[model samples]
Target: MLKEFREFISRGNVIDLAVGIIIGAAFTGIVNSLVNDVLMPPLGFIMGGIDFSSYFINLSGGDYASLKAAQDAGATTINYGLFVNAVIKFFIVSVSVFILVKQVNRLHRREQAKPSAPPAQEVLLREIRDLLRDGAPPRVIPAADSRTV
Candidate 1:
C-alpha cells in the first residue's frame, strides 16, 4: 500500500495537479489584490465616491455610520457590498483562466496542425522500398514541384 501511494504521488498527473493547485492559490491572492487595490478604487470614484464595501443593510436595529462601524458595534448586518467585491473578483479570475486556457489550446492546435518531417534515413528507406516494389526506380520530381513521392 505504501509503494502504491508512492507510485501515485510520483505520477505526472499528481505532480501536475499539485503544481496547478499551488499556482491557483497564488493567483487568487493576485486577483484579490487587483480587485481591492487597483480596480475598486477607480470604480468607486466613477460611482461618485461610493465604496461598495460599505453598502450593507443593518439587520440589527442600531444605525451605524459604516459597515465597519456596524460590525464594531456588534450589529448583525447583511454584507452585500463585500459580496459584490467577491463577485467582481470571481469574474476577473474566471476571465483570466479562460484566456489562459484558450491560448494554451491555440498553441496545441498549431502544434497539431504542423506536419512533422520524417528523418533523412526514414525517407531514404521509404524511397528504396518503393523502388524495390516497382520494376523501375522512383521518379524524382523537380524541387519546384511538391517534393512528396
Candidate 2:
C-alpha cells in the first residue's frame, strides 16, 4: 500500500497539481489585496468616501455607522458591500484565467495548423494521383517480389 501511495505521489500530474494549488492560493491573496486595498479606496474616494464594505443592511434593528461597528455589536447583517468586493474579485480572477486559457488554446491551434511532411507512402500515392489527373497512362505499382498487376 505504501509503495502504491509513493508511486501516486511521484507522478508528474500530482506535482503539477500541487504547484498549481500553491500558485492559485497566492493569486487569490493578490486578487483580494488588489480589490480591497487598491480598487475600493479610489472608488470610495470617488463616491464621497463611502466605502463599499460599509454598505450593509443591519437586520438587528440597530443603526450602526459602519459594517464593522454593527458586526462588533453582534448584529445580524446582510453584508452586501463585502459581497460586491467578492464579486469584483471573482470577475478579475475569472477574466485572467479565461485570457490565459484562450492564449494556451491559440498556441495549440497554431501548432495544429502547421503542416508537417507527409509520410513516404502518402507522397508516393499523391504522385500517382497527380500523374493520373494529368491524363498519364495508368501504371501498376510493383510489389515487393517485383510483380505488377
Candidate 3:
C-alpha cells in the first residue's frame, strides 16, 4: 500500500497538479494585489472616493464609521466591499488564465498545422518501390514536350 501510494504521488499527473496548485495560490495573491493596490484606488476615486471595503451593512444596528470600526466593536456586519474586491480579483485571475490558455492553444494549433517533410530515406524508398511496381525506370521528359512519348 505504501509503495502504491508512493507510485501515485510520483506520477506525472499528480506532480503537475501539485505544481498547478502552488502556482494558482501564488497567482491568487498577485490578482488580489492588482485588485486592492492597483485597480481599486483609481476606481474608488472616480466613484467619489467610495471605498468598497468600507461599504457594509451593520446588522447589529450600531452606527460605525468604517468596516474596521464595526469589526473592532464585534458588530455583525455584511461586508460587501470585501466581496467586491474578491469579485474583482476573480475577474482578473480568470482573464489572465483565459489569455494564457488561448495562447497555449494557439501555439498547439500552429505546431499541429505545420506540414512536416517526409524523411529523405522514406522518400527514396517510396520512389524505388513505385519504380519496381510499375516495372519501369524513371523517364525524364524534355520540358518542351507535353506528351509522354
Candidate 4:
C-alpha cells in the first residue's frame, strides 16, 4: 500500500497537477491585485468616484456609512458591489488563463511543424541496395548532361 501510494505521488500527472495548483494560487493573488489596485481606481473615478465596494442595499432600515459599517452594526445587507468586484476578478483570471493556454498551444504547434532528420545509415543502405540491384555504381549527376562515349 505504501509503495502504491508512492507510485501514485511520483506519477507525472500528479506532479504536474501539484505545480499547476501552486501556480494557480499565485496567479489568483496577481489577478486580485490587478483588479483591486490597478483597474478599480480608474474605473471608479470614471464612474464619478462611486466606490463599488460600498455599493449595497440595506435590508435592515438603519443608515450605514459603508458596507463594512453596516456589517459591523449587525445589519443584513445585499452587498452587490463585492459581487461585481468578484465577477470582474473572474473575467480577468479567465482571460489570462485563455491567453496562457493559447500561447502554449502555439508553441506546441511550432514544435510539431519542424522537420525531423532522416536516418543517415538507412538512406546509405537503401542507396547501396538500389545500386546492387540495378548493376550500376552510384555516380553523381553533373549540372549539365554529358554524353558518355
TM-score of each: 0.76, 0.81, 0.77, 0.76
lDDT of 2: 0.94
lDDT of 3: 0.92
The local distance difference test score of each candidate is 0.94, 0.94, 0.92, 0.93
Could you tally the backbone clashes for each prediction? 0, 0, 1, 0
Q: Which ranges in model 3 have alpha carbons more than 4 Å from their true place?
A: 116-149
Location of the lowest summed lDDT over 10 successive residues in candidate 3: 139-148
Clashing pairs in 2: none
lDDT value for model 1 = 0.94
Worst 10 residues of 4 by lDDT: 140-149
Cα RMSD to native, each candidate?
9.7, 4.2, 9.0, 9.4
Residue 83 alpha-carbon offset, candidate 4, angstroms: 1.1
TM-score pick, better of 1 and 2: 2
Q: What is the per-residue lDDT of model 3 for residues 7-126, given as tens digits with 9 covering 90 to 100?
A: 999999999999999999998888878888999999999999978988999999999999999999999999999999888888888889899999999999999999999999999999
User: Is candidate 2 or 4 superior in TM-score?
Assistant: 2
Runs of candidate 4 with Cα error greater than 4 angstroms are 116-149
